[model samples]
Target: MSAATVSSSPKITEKMARESPAEQAQVLVKSRICNPNFIFSIFSNPPDSNYSKLKYIISSSLTEACNNSVLLLGPRGCGKVAILELVLEDLLEEYPDMISVIKLNGLLHCDHNCALKEISRQLCQEHQLLFSKMASFDDNAQFMVSMLRECGLAHKTIIFVLDEFDLFAQGKQLFLYSLLDAMQSVTSQAVVIGISCRLDADQLLEKRVRSRFSHRKLLFLPPSREDTERLLEHILLLPTNSSFPHEYVTAFNVKLLKIFADYKFKEIVDTLSYSDSTVNHLQRFLFSTVSHMDLKSGLLSLENFKAALSTIQRQPKLEVLKDCSILELYILVCMKRLEAKEQELRNFNAIMKEYKSIHDTFQTSNYYARNVCLRAFEHLLQRELISFEDNRGHGQSAEFRPVKLLISRPELYQGLKSYPSCPVSSF
Candidate 1:
């Protein structure tokens, strides 16, 4: 086949197609996962009932401190993006003629300069008539100032919602300071709504910027297990005729939801789908006469679970392993490592070294090994089971240190105990 034709072909195998309905349902559900957006759309809108609490707070701010900024700080996946979308919808209704909402996700632009440039570019493109005279300027900061001037002259209010504000706070202190200063100097009535994973006390905004936002309300949202369960139910209710069994869903709630509650709703859905695939694969390995009930409990048993681990370890190539849902394996492996060390936190280097030793003994590189390890780390981080600290200075390699490990998987940890450690600490 031509390269183009080969690339266009479906990658999943025929065997995967014949998997259990539950497994297929998991995959179908996750395949429809949506990337969080800032726009106010029908699919993205929050339930009206959830808005009452937030509306009062925002309305109070708009009435009392029209010029000051509001900062919403919370843990990741605590509905910051949803709240912003809801607020945007509210702004449209409450201040239709007077205000315009501009939303931006900071993570999309990795660099400070690039972020500001894009923001300016977007504003100019969005309000071409108002900014046509100043469009020739190459300086983004200057362009932003001019745009603010125009907004002040024409609109009663302009609100800028900076989502993922923590990304910018990490190394873009100067950029934030300058933006705040420029906003403060604007003749037009303007305010900012900043959303971040860290609270204001934990953030490093400059004194001036901090003071500017002082009068504005600061709301902190912490993730709750209840919210996660509710979110799962919401997702399961999406498909018109989803065949995901209630028993399977209940198992997910008990075994996975609590452990992974800190993850974004989408992340949790992806992990569950991967786990379902793992369960399906295990079932296929069993004899045809074995009841599905026996297979289910067998896969959950310590001995059979270890056997599955062995199967993963014996995989000759990473490519094959990756295609078979290595994320589930990685999670199991990480849990096992934590149990073996009896440590609350597993250093990144230690985990990588252990994996290298295992690979060496097998005389092969598992294609998904490195990526699986990283995904596991990300999962722990998302769950707040681990806190990763990257000590590398700017433009240097990042070193990861896991601060904690939540769930314990003893079988996986025992498997790693047999492997020798690698020399490099990069992992």
Candidate 2:
């Protein structure tokens, strides 16, 4: 066959045209070198402020120990991993010859053991030739110790960044304990940086492991509204432009940006891109739902907008709630109820009573109460709407209090005031 005849195909041209605009845009964007301006612009001035309080915690921990282990605690998309990457970048620039960084995200694996094995495998691959002599150590601990020795001697420091570290700790606590013990023996020249979304005080770290990382507990505060807005502006603005169209940016639409911006910069971008792909999903809902009416009204008062939101809230598919879990729903209800009362639910018992009243209104059976409440409380704590003041015992019976309930769905609050009991079921 002639090369020209084979190359000139109408089918291929048609296929290219059929590709989505967003996908085509992505392909074009990915084909070019990443724009440094775009990357840097997403970050605000005094760059440290963009990081919230985490920047200080990370810097303080690194300054304290040449061989430190830090547990960054926050919910998913809260930017624990991004901050670590930024720290790694800084470390590499400051001590290129002395530092060797390895980052492993635990969520990629099937379980904690698999995550550990993957990390070990990656470490082996990276420094295979250097640790060729210590190949006899078959177990992970021995292997890690041998690798640490090689790294310590060859480089001044070695940092292992474990993102989603909770995945590894969930069922494989013993394995983590062993890993931490092994890392502790690294001649004061190695460190481990662990990141996780949940920070159960009792389960945050094993007692022995906790002792090792006590001084390095870095809590990442959620980004402020102002910081979130600035971050969103950076995200929406193209590198070529200093500002985006005002029509494309507004307070009502800004909540989506704020929600995603609460996470790390990279995560915010990933979520935004995902939201863009399903743009119609939200847009459809907006038009068919309250947002559509609110837009038409032209005077989007907070109260009216909230009322519209309440109507739309009831119509969400059950599948979405299932994916979010009963506990998540329970927490959502608690937040709504508290907002309805126009008083912050500070006391643990008081919050529980409010939750129980809603549960009773829903007629949740006795068998379901404990499990449902536990799940809801845990989810709320994970999302930073509430926190555990004390854990009377291990596992599910722990007591918790609202640290601060950041409820964005103001409409749900208003709706609950009229029908407090089982407001979810009422509409």
Candidate 3:
């Protein structure tokens, strides 16, 4: 695999030159590495992999037509959800007619009522039943239990995937209790699989709910540095036997290897991994890098990764502050000034007082009206530039609620530098 082979291939060069930008992109898309579906094959379950362990548990329960429950715990990007999906996908293929799956997320269906409504909705969709919102809590509960019984009678195994499982443990734990209790009945054959980022997720369950659970937990951790490097190579290196010309594939892989060995590229990867070393973060980074590929620059280089790193690492809060009105910037500056003075329990009221002090001291002509400043404060809150302290009661007025600036000093400096109409002399 040498650069000379690529340059010597006149046929390949001619074909590339003749192809339009869209046509070249289509060619690139044909590469197995460039396609998401094809890429997942590289991540499929191995003989002794975690994928196999999970598949064994879920598949055995489905085969026996028995109720079972297990929890998957890992930090974000550890492939907890991905592995489950892969296992379930293969299992569903093996027992398509006998298996059904329902997915619920903690972020969306955290509340018991909302979760029940969503479960009813999903069950209705899956079974082709006309879904109607039941009028009472008892009616909805009965309906769900009846649906489970119906599925069980028909020998269909229902698999429930609860994402952010810890959130479902909130409140009265009614959802968790009801689902687990239903699993206990002889008429129900269902498997509950919970996925959570928290390692102590199992400890969060109520005593009753925990008693019904199978006490099986699978933990996932982020890949080590070596594994991450291997993943990068696996994703970027073109297949030798792919549709592309042999010379092009070799040349592309060679360039990719060189880029991987570069210290600058390693630095970029380190910077990304320092904050978030998850597969999800790597996916986003790669997606950005790959988007820069084109007919002219068909092969990736160190520059592409550097550019992608810059784009991904940008602070969105700074961008939002740059677009803010002058009054809003003034409020933020006041907060920064108050922070510098080591003031304690600063809130909207304190910010206003600080602003007045500055206004009177400087006699600034652009002093925004008090009502306008109030509106600006509200706008800042909405933008998440400032957040109210959690210890403050909900009934407390907004003006008196202790607040903190979300942006750092460096970000503040950067944003002010970019604001074209910043009143430098007034401050």
* Candidates arranged by lDDT, highest first: 3, 1, 2
Itemize residue pairs with steric clashes in candidate 2. 74-197, 77-263, 79-264, 327-376
Model 3 lDDT, residue 156, Cα? 90
**lDDT of each residue in 19-50, candidate 1, tens digit only:** 76445544433332232221112223343333
lDDT (Cα, tens digit) per residue for candidate 3, span 18-115: 77543443355434333433334445535656677888888888778899989999998778887787677677777889888889999999888888
User: What 10-residue stretch in candidate 1 is worst by lDDT?
Assistant: 1-10
Clashes per prediction?
Answer: 4, 4, 0
How much lDDT does each candidate structure score? 0.49, 0.49, 0.78
lDDT of predicted model 3:
0.78
The lowest-lDDT stretch of 10 consecutive residues in candidate 2 is 1-10
Candidate 2 lDDT, tens digit per residue, 171-208?
53665666666666636466777777677633755677
Clashing pairs in 1: 152-188, 318-366, 318-367, 336-413
Q: What is the TM-score of each candidate against the true structure?
A: 0.46, 0.48, 0.67
Error of 2 at 249 (Å): 15
Off by over 4 Å in 1: 1-54, 60-65, 105-115, 130-143, 153-155, 170-172, 199-202, 215-223, 237-427
Prediction RMSDs, each to the true structure: 14.7, 13.6, 9.1
